[model samples]
Target chain A: MAAPILVFGHKNPDNDAISAAVGYAYLKNELAKRAGSDAVYEACRLGGLPPETEWILGENGIEAPRLIESLSEGQQVILVDHNETLQSADGLDAAEIVEIVDHHRLGGLVTAQPLRFNAKPVGSTAAIVAREFEIEGVELPRGIAALLLGAMLTDTVIMKSPTTTDFDRDIIARTAAAVGVDPVEYGMSIFKCRSNPAELPVDKLVNADAKEFELSNGNKVYIGQYETVDLQAVLGREAEIREAIKGLVADKGYQFVLFFATDILAEGSQFICEGDTDFVNRAFDIDCTGKSVWMPGVLSRKKQVAAPILAL
Target chain B: MAAPILVFGHKNPDNDAISAAVGYAYLKNELAKRAGSDAVYEACRLGGLPPETEWILGENGIEAPRLIESLSEGQQVILVDHNETLQSADGLDAAEIVEIVDHHRLGGLVTAQPLRFNAKPVGSTAAIVAREFEIEGVELPRGIAALLLGAMLTDTVIMKSPTTTDFDRDIIARTAAAVGVDPVEYGMSIFKCRSNPAELPVDKLVNADAKEFELSNGNKVYIGQYETVDLQAVLGREAEIREAIKGLVADKGYQFVLFFATDILAEGSQFICEGDTDFVNRAFDIDCTGKSVWMPGVLSRKKQVAAPILAL
Candidate 1:
């Protein structure tokens, strides 16, 4: 039999990343059982789960995937949530990535073998994994459904983020029903439970949910997003956050660092950036005369923000 | 409504590439019709269709897609049979690629937006397109079934190549039944019509069905395959073919160029290589002491040849 396949997400595991890894492994194993395949599937994580992810998994009675520092040469793996090798686990270059189910922009990941790569323009990787279950005609357990629903709601910001699609909304409703929860009530509770800006350190707040991008002009930019019900609290600590962002930018040699504080309740975001001020001003159409700027109705970093910046 | 999406395959259009472009466009249009979407799907070709592809389309009463040299900036496109920018039309970097359906190894193709990229490890892109039809519950037309079946048979060498999968076989059977033809008989006829190495000039023979790969060692190699009933006919013109290959290598600046003369009837191949003999010997485990080496039961360039060479 082939060695067990390791299914994991990128480093700094978030709610969608952790949920996608677990959900994809379950779906693969169920499909394998129907096909009578002998290969085993194990869900893993590149880093320790964030507090919100830990809470969701614990509440759903799902054990958190084991954290792995690195992989051995020729180890088979299935990546979920992210495809950039920089974002993946250490020694990923030596691993045989058999499948990738991602919802982000394509990174420069090339493989020797032609494997199954399913990337869709959806809000969350969990919605894609849940759709796979529906496509394969596999019945989802209540626990898995809850985890996937949680991921969908978190990633799409309760269907208020610009990244949210009709398909995401459809899957959220079905998965929420399967788990016996009202999506709106549950999503709000999950957001309120996780959004504790006052308690989180400036570093943790900026690095909680971040993505790095290498632009065509060879500029590396990091965008970090933090969602909360209380945006004013985050803006109150703008000076400390700016210092943290500057430190991160210098340490990581990032050309720019932009941290977005998304107000889930207000349906907008405030941006604190340490980068080329002129470029930032033109990209967002906001006059950043101060350290922070409130950009109303700019909830999605993906469609609303990243797309235009990357295109430029 | 968005502008009509131009669907096309890679340069040097083969049967699979041409057929897949047509089939995928048809499938997408059918799905859009059911959903009442205003987006029109127009099939196109990056290069002129091969003689065999032309014949097949003529037999099915399907007009050949308009040949296009390059795309304008921001023109929306759905690539079929290939995803490599190197193999794609010029200005592809500027084009807004919305979706990709392919069966080849992933090249270094990075997109700014998250699009629908469905790449599977199947023998033919036609098979993947047919599976999409099934997934979307769209019934295939008789003409489309014939075109797709012809592509599947040709790409997999009538189920003899190592790239042939069970899913490909399943699609072939269904497509054959829909087209009202015996799969074996129809496949043999297509091969017989196309496998005329003696009639083809040296350049055309090598350029007929070729794929370029960039190795891990930063070496660019071009592997070209020619299918025929008799390998001896190719061996008789070895000197001329070698000269032609050397000219191609010099003109294209390829690190290595290997041409495989595959005998469909014998189910074996003869190799004529023109670069780094030691590396070639180590790559395929064949002693190429002379210009030509006959290897038995090595029919697939993708699975048997390219995979190992690229891995090395």
Candidate 2:
């Protein structure tokens, strides 16, 4: 018998990463069963869950996926939520990536063979996976429905993020109805239940939602986003945050490091950086104090942060 | 108004590439019309159509897509049948790739932003486009149905190639019925109308259907397949074929170049390769006469030839 395929998300997985991996695995397994194929899919994660992901999984009574630090050569795997080798499990290039379901920009990941790659410009990978269920005519269980809806809500900030698409909103409404919950209320609850940054050490806060990227010019940039109801608390600790960013830059040899304190209630974000002030000013059209800048109505890192930085 | 998004296939487009681009554009336009969006989609091609593709287009009375050499920066585009930068149009990285519907392995093509990338491990890109039509609840027009069906038939070699999937077969039957033609009769007609290699120069015959790849070890491999009614005609000129392959290898600096003459009638293939004879022998387990070898029932370059070669 063929070995079961492992489905996983990138390290430091967010809510969408966790939910989409599980949802996509369920969809694949259901399709295989209908076709009488002996293929099995096991959902996994590259690292421990964040506080928000843990809360959602517990609320839905879904078990957290097994943690896998690395994959061996020839191991068959499917990636969800992320496709960049830097964000994936260690030794990912050695593994056979059979499929990828993601909602992020294309990274430097090449496959040795042709596989099913379903990527979309929507707010959440869960929306893409939910659409797959609809396309394949598979009914979603309540737990899966809730998990998918929660993912979409969190990723889109309840349809407020710039990344939200009409399809994502439609999937959010449908899955929310399937799970018997009000999307707005549930979305707010999930955000409220997130870990408080004030309670964590400066390094932990910076690393909690961090993502690293290699620019076209071969320079590495790291961005960390912390979503909260209060941004002033983080702003008050600007010196500590800058210290943490400096430590990350020194340790990882990053050319630049940025942190965004996103206020979910205000639908805005405060951007802090420990990078070249001239580049940051030119990229965002703001005077940098080597500290922080207030950017109202900028909550999407993919569009507002990563796009401009990559363009540079 | 936003400019019309150009939908195109790779260079040296085959039946599947041309048909999928046109068919997908039609489906996207239909969906946009339903949504009352002003976004327009124009079907295009990066290179000229082959004889078989021209014949299929003429039979359905469908206008051919416009030929495009390169795109300017920020031009929105959608790709079908291929996603590799080496095979795509010039200036593809500068253009905004809004979507991709392909059947080939993912290449080193990185998009600046997330887009809709619908790739599948199926036999034909037309099958994926047809499935998209079904998903969007758009009824296929007679001309489109004919073009799509013809593409699937040719790409899968009348369901005889190992690359064909059950999904491809089902799509073939459904699309054939929709076009009011028996699949077998139409498929044979398409094959019989292909360009006769016996009439063309050896160089042209070798270049007509060539595809290039960069193996994991950074070696370049070029594989060209010619579908013919009689493989003996090609085998009879084995010396000339080898000379053509050698010319290609020297001109392109390829590590190896292989030419496969696939017999539609005999359901087998004659392989002629130039360069790295030892590696080719080890890959296929055939004692190379340094000229040609007959591999009965090895009809798929993607599955039978390329996969094994890339594995090395």
Candidate 3:
């Protein structure tokens, strides 16, 4: 048999990033088996698992995906959840991307060989992965259904994120039904299982779900989001958070570092920025240079937050 | 209602290019109408229609897509068959691409907003479009079904091209059955409908379906293909074709210009080159410096010819 193809999500993996990889890998394996091809897909991640993802995997008696920092040159891989090089594995430029299943904006990635790319402007990558299962006519295992349902809820902030569309809602409803769980109740439980933001080290909270983006001026900016039920727990450490991010900006020479804490219950977020704040300030029409600004109804980092800043 | 979104294919339109755009735009319009959205999708072609495409549309009493050369800034658009900017319409950088349905390699297209992108490494974009109609549960009108089947056959060289996969064969079969025609018979009729290659003007023969590509050295190259049952007619015009493309290399500063004539019956192509031939010699291990080289089993330009050249 040939070597197994690696299937992974972006670095700094969140629930959707890691869960989508695992689900998509299983789907591909089934497809390969039915076709009688000697191909295997192994799911991997590039970072630590979030508390909610870890909880779901443990509850379902499923092992976490293997952790990998970089890829070998010419290794065949499939990227899920994200496709941009800046947000992918460390050695992505040297690796061969055979397929991609993402739900983010295109990021100027070029490839030489023709491959399968499936993306939709939906709320979660898990929703896309789940829908593919139906299209491929593969039966969804119960444990996998639960895991995917959990990521779908968290990624969409319990269906309240602005990125949620009719497609997301339909898939979420079908998957949640298959898992025998109420969508809202299950979502609340997952958010509650997250590690307490107030007790975490400032660095961990800021980098939990962050991504690197390039501005139009060719400068790199960092945007992070930490979603919790209590926003005050995160805001209480604003000074320390700012100091931690400022250190990153200085050490990494980043154009800026913006961290936002989203309160799932309140459906809003608080933004704290370090380094040059002009982009965020002008994009959102708010000055958060010295103080944190509370943005009402800002739930999704991809759609509501980073998208506007990147547009600037 | 907002402005109608324009849908188009590559600049040098082929049968698959223009036909796929027409099929996809029709599918999008149906979806919008089902959802009660006032989104209108207008199918447009970037270049003159292929003779086969014109025959199919005329046979079905369907109108040809509008011809467009450039796009206005901020105009919403959808791309089909091809995704590379170098192969797309002029002013593509300024237009907003809201969706893409293609079967080619990624080409460094960046967008500020997330959009729907569906690509597969199957034989033809028409196959993908036909599958979408099934997925959306929209009834395939007989005219459109016949139109799509024609493209699927021509693009895959009647299922003889190496790029043809199980997916393409399955969709082609289903669509042909729906249209009440034998697949091979219909395909031959479409190929026979194509205009005689020998009688074409020299420039039109050379630039009929050519596309510009950038090499690793950051230099541009142009590649064109002419497929026919008669290869002798094209081979007889080698002198005239060489003279025409050499003029292009001198006027446009291209690194090289490669043109091939594929005999569908023989399943081979004759490659002719002008300007720098190092790239071609190294890619295929053939010397066509001043003489034509016959490459056996080279039917699809994208899969058999361009892919190897670009990989280098």
Top candidate on lDDT is 3
Off by over 4 Å in 3: none
Compared with the true structure, what per-residue lDDT tens digits does model 3 show for residues B1-312?
769999998998998998898898899999999999999999999989888999999999989999998999999999999889999888998999999999999999998888999999999999999999999899999999999999999999999999999999999989999999999999999988887888989888888888999998899999999989889988999999999999999999999999999999999999999999999999999999999999999999988899889888
Residue-wise lDDT of candidate 1 within A128-190, one digit each (tens)? 999999988999999899989999999999999888988898999989989999999998888
Chain A TM-score, cand. 1 = 0.95
Q: Which prediction has more favorable lDDT, 1 or 3? A: 3
Each candidate's chain A: what TM-score?
Answer: 0.95, 0.96, 0.99
Q: All candidates: CA RMSD in angstroms?
A: 1.9, 1.8, 1.1
TM-score of each: 0.96, 0.96, 0.99
lDDT of 3 by residue, A1-312 (tens): 888899999889999999999999999999999999999999999999999999999999989999998988999999999989999998888899999999999999999878899999999999999999999899999999999999999999999999999999999999999999999999999999999988988888999999999999999999999999888889889989999999999998899999999988888999999999999999999999988999999999998888898887
Fraction of the reference Cα-Cα interface contacts (below 8 Å) that each candidate reproduces: 0.84, 0.84, 0.89
What are the lDDT scores of the predictions, listed in order? 0.87, 0.86, 0.93
Instruction: Give lDDT tens digits, candidate 2, residues A30-134.
Output: 999999999999899877687777887887798998888899888899999998998888888789999999999888677667899999999999999999898
Per-residue CA lDDT of model 1 for B153-272, tens digit only, reads 999999999899888988899889888999989989888887467767788888888877777778777888988876788788899988888887788888878998999889999988
- Position A84, candidate 3: lDDT: 99
In model 1, where do residues sit more than 4 Å from their true spots? A275-279, A287-290, B217-219, B276-278, B287-290
| Candidate 3 residue-wise lDDT at A204 | 88
